[model samples]
Target: MKRLVGLFAALLLLVGGLASPAQAAGTLNWTAGDSITAYTSAPTTATPGATTIVFENSAATGNTTGMPHTLTFDTSTEGYNHDVSLNILANPFDANNGRHEATVTLTPGRYRYFCSIPGHSTMVGEFVVTDGPGPDPDTTPPTVTAAAAGTQDANGNYVGTATVTVTATDNTGGSGVDKVEYALDSGAFQAYTAPVAVSTAGAHTVRYRATDKSGNASTEGSLAFTVVEPAPEEDTTPPTVNHALAGTQDDDGNYVGSATATLTATDDDSGVDRIEYSLDGGAYTAYTAPVVVSTAGMHMLHYRATDKAGNTSAEKMAHFTVVPAEEPDTTPPTVVAEVDGEQNENDAYVGRATVTVTANDTESEVASIQYALDSGAWLAYTQPVVITGLGAHTVRARATDTAGNTSPEKTVTFTVVGTGSDACEVPDTRTTVVIDGDDTGVPNADTGDGCTINDLIDEYASYPNHAAFVRHVETVTAALVAGGTLTKRQQGTIVRAAARSDIGS
Candidate 1:
């Protein structure tokens, strides 16, 4: 009993830590249940002994029997206590079968050896430990390996004649590199000669298979390398744009509307930096990040791009314009008579004429206009109004803001019926009214057409006018007399206005 307890204590210490790599570790071939005469040839009976032992997958899984018997060893028993067992399941995270020489400690006397398996306890055996680190477990298994790391170059691509360090190591014995050969992706094997060149573009993996001096060959492991072309000439070409992509049609009565357009472009060298744009010969503005537009108007859009080389791309234009559904005019324009006709005798003769006016506004301004004649036809008027044959017409006018806000009607009642030629003398109380395309002279010569003083200064540029303007038109008549350059009506009207002004002044 004393010797037995001492043997158990010795086994406890040895099995506590682990074994070194030199130990021969492997499993013995066994059938079902059996016992051997001895585990080692000469066994020792001392309290403390040293030697190594091994467990092997023995039971033969016949052509038709149940799966081979699973072997398991439990350190639950007092004499067989151990820190942990070599297992693929309940051990360290990285666990694989074939790792040999998992060292274990033991003492003299009958030590129990059991299969580290499930449902196979009857195959357990008792072994005797002798001197030295007990029976050495077979640590020699096919040590599979391949090449070491290759050169990782600047710019992250592999360069030069790539040489892979072809080396293989084993557990107990060093590499048996004689029969070792290399094969590339399922092709025939090549002897482990010199390092092969990996010059192909892109990435590639080379695998090495080491065959020991023994016929035993190790499985293949691979090393990866990358081969890429020098970045394709640095890509410095600038991008271009298309014009047929010009745009949709709209009635601007002027040009095109506002459009945030993208200039289609490409680069073969340094790539495109940005696309700038301008409209209606406007200042060039920064490009839209995603090439979008918000401004509304009819304009000429100019576009361009620049590359990293400081090279500017050819300017392109997308006559793109953003049009409002309808052009807006919001301002309430001041209404004035463009031309007033003659006033006849005392029937309150006030002539109706064209009130030439323009609207001023921003986005979607004045939508419509309303005019009431003598509190009548709140009618829509366009460019001209010929309010005919009225003794006195009360013209009430109002403008509607684009948003439908209507303004107060501006009413003006003027006498249209004039006194007879013998009874009425034309009033000369004229206030100087500055008008566009009118006479510049302050005390301008009056033309007696039975027309008033104001009418003389503001003569029609097209038809009847003062002497200075008449002289201009005569030059045109000279051109016409040579041919049909000027019409007869134009020449005659000029001659009449000049003669009439000379007599009236």
Candidate 2:
């Protein structure tokens, strides 16, 4: 029995070694269901020092202008093992389906998010955290336009086949649409409700709804599609399209797509007014502005303009007639080619910018200017570069315009100068002191190099450092000994005079 127990312990240790720091599942499932932000984000960015724990209110319940939801993380525990909660429910406190989404950044380690909201955990959902970027922002929300709610049949009776034409677009790559589903007159909803084959003999009403794995839901307006059996002609007369022209995107469809405007319109009453516009045509809107759509193909301008009085025009009538602004390279001129200052490389005298200025705009004029000093502050200006105090200085330049348009940063290096190293000059020889040769007369400044020995003593006394004075006195004594300049007896006299100090008063 003891042998068997030891063998079991060894096996357990081996199993533990095989595990990784990240969750074993390899993916962190997010919260998704009836009470989730179908078109929002998780793991939203927060300033580094602001808050360590990431948070997002993706629940539909507390999301209605002040619903309560809490999110937090462990910044103190370094190696990443944190708790998460996603047990949100529909109104009236009931557990939702298996769908889930709970996002939070992890420290390259295991993470778990569970609904601590009562019994909802067993039914609602949970999530995990791993080291990877989150979902794609471009994944569109499922279009939820309400199809014509009612349509007539051959019997001239109000009816529904309970089947609506749902166009599902998938972004999981390759797959067009996986599944489609609809509810029957508010009946028990089922999983098989899309692209349905309703076999009702007459008309029926239905509600169509769907979503993608990213949990993007179709809107309410896309809910009901008219169920019909093909009626007679009625959409004749060239189908009068009210306003159709194209330019830029409007507030209505904010989706980021190819920046082109293509349009087609029809007027059952009167023909279209001349489509007049200009691209930089004086700050126009997506609908009300004028643009020169020079490219013959379709494009978006201020799609709609006006005539004499004021008739609403339509642009981008044909959804597919997109313009090619991306081709024109409308990305504002490169700010790089404009600024200057690449000289002296020093902390004191850094930038050598003589005339650092903003470049002339290709599309517009060089508007205004500004500058920054180190990582310190941003300053506005009409000047090219800013210089506070010259020597030992570091500077930067900023160029802008009246439109608050700014140019890229440009560097102009310069440096400050200071006094150089030049020591005090001195003469090699002077008629200041002298010494006679042999055992001769008394010592005197009159013996050789100029000044009297009395004056020399007076000057030496004025020296600030007594030690420096003593050292210079020794040098003078040695010079006398090296002769040529003084006689032997004079040298002796000089040495005696140099060594003697003024004693007492």
Candidate 3:
């Protein structure tokens, strides 16, 4: 009997040594009432190892049949694990008030603890398992980076298509990166799965962020960039053309002699590539310098310009005429005379006479007109010329053209009779005096009688001084008759014979 008792004591000591301490597992306490389900003090975080959960029922203490309740643990909400469920507690006021205890091995993860009994699922809580002994909390958020490959212009604007890539990283290795999201132009955030393509024009904004598996989110990061339209598909506008010239122009826009037609072309988008021109509706040719148009008469020129982008300008045309040099004038002027007076049968004026001369020319205007009386110096003729002489008078006129050509002299004759006795006096004439018989000495004698005088005048009436010469001849003839040299009839016959002869007086 002593040996058996000694053996039992030794066995008791060994069992006590094998049992674990009450504080070895984390304590999670829960309670249930008449119709309510809740937890007194449940642990939110536990070390990676064994965890203890204590449940108590107190419905019977309230004077009503206690409802049975159960505690369960699961990897996800509403996914209860039958193996981790605690035995049901039915008695409310029994010893220890239906108290129960459960222990479970926990790894590093998040878990859900709730009652699996009908109508008790509402009582739930969260459970987190971590490394042993005051493990560090996941406070560091994830970092996100965004990059793009696109062309940049001088203004820092992105041109053409761009590929945008986003990446996320976490420093906490326990809960790595969860997900990365991005937003464009304040739009809604979307999960970033692949590279994004940006192909629009103008400015834009991008926002990105990342989250860690431990529910830690990073601050949003922003990036600004501009997208410009692709270089305008080959310039399509044509070049402009300008033309200039240096020379004298006529009323018809015509230039005389040689002249240069200068052409200039300009383009706004693309530089001018070439210039072409055509003359008189002829074939087109490239132009390098000013064109020389030396031909006379009307001319038509067609020109155009093209840009480097293969754009051609509308055809432009210009018209001009050229004149030749002037020639010299060689035509002489014509002169016309006008007389203002009454004329006799022999073209002798009975009263005062006025004469006017007019000159005209075809090629050049008349320069001057000159007039002269018989045997008188020439004078410029501004107005009409008046002739007041009492005998036959002569007038001469001539004209000169602007080209220095002088016309032949033109002459006209007119006569004026005065209202006096001297006006009847015969004009001076040339005649001879003769005697019928020889008279040695003849003193002053009576001239021939009136009948002899009349015969002498009638014989030499056509002579200029016939009347004067006739009187002298009569006197000489009478001297001879008085000296007994000739008879009266003979004297008259001798005077008439002298007037008929061409002898000196």
Of the candidates shown, which would achieve the greatest TM-score relative to the real structure?
Answer: 3
When summed lDDT is taken over every stretch of 10 residues in candidate 2, the lowest stretch is: 9-18
lDDT of 1 by residue, 1-505 (tens): 3343233223322234345545524222223222222211222222242223332322221212112222233556676534434321111111212112345444443444444435444545434344555545433435655543445568556754455657665545332344556665456778776767665566667777776533456676777767665445655456764433334445643223434444556666777776677767878877655444446654566778777777787786655456544555454444433435555454233433334334433544676776655534466645444443223455667666566656666665554432333221453434332234233233322222243333432234353223344443333233333334234564454445544553222
Evaluate model 1: give its TM-score: 0.25
lDDT of 2 at 282: 38
Choose 1 or 2, whichever is better by lDDT: 1
Candidate 1 contains a number of clashing pairs equal to 56
Q: Where is model 2 more than 4 Å wrong at Cα? A: 1-356, 365-368, 384-390, 400-408, 417-505
lDDT-wise, the better of 2 and 3 is 3
Per-model tally of clashing residue pairs: 56, 77, 3
Each prediction's whole-model lDDT (CA): 0.45, 0.38, 0.65
Identify the runs in model 1 with alpha carbons over 4 angstroms from their true place.
1-236, 240-258, 262-269, 283-285, 288-298, 311-314, 326-505
